[model samples]
Target: MPHADTLTVVHHDDTKTRYTDVRYQLIRDGIRIWSREGEHSLTDILMTHAYRRREQKH
Candidate 1:
């Protein structure tokens, strides 16, 4: 499983058609692992962390 230290880039557009790119750095053991870039929803990011945590628990 990947650690939260991974950074994920999420691109999105507002109702006005303005593009917004958000970069999220995953924190695990006080370090960063990897990164990704793409258009993602807030729910997607949250679910990613949730899934990572669950995986780590096993």
Candidate 2:
């Protein structure tokens, strides 16, 4: 499980279309800490998390 304050990935779409882009949002403490739009795979969420985790050490 993820810590409520440190990790979360919201996979959602903003539009209805054949090419509708998905969004990956990194949330912490009820606010968005990072976001990426126009991705094709839900896997982007995990990739974002991995990347963010490294940066969080700073």
The reply for model 2, stretches above 4 Å from the true place, is 1-5, 13-58
Q: What would the per-residue lDDT of candidate 1 be over residues 1-58, giving only the tens digit for each residue?
A: 3433333333232212122233344454222223355533333222232122343554
Q: Tell me the TM-score of each prediction against the true structure.
A: 0.17, 0.16
Q: Pick the candidate with the highest TM-score.
A: 1
> What's the CA error at residue 25 for candidate 2, in Å?
14
Q: Clash pairs of candidate 1?
A: 4-26, 5-26
- The lDDT of each candidate is 0.32, 0.31
Across 1-58, the per-residue lDDT of candidate 2 in tens digits comes to 1222233344444322221222334344222332234233333232232222233554
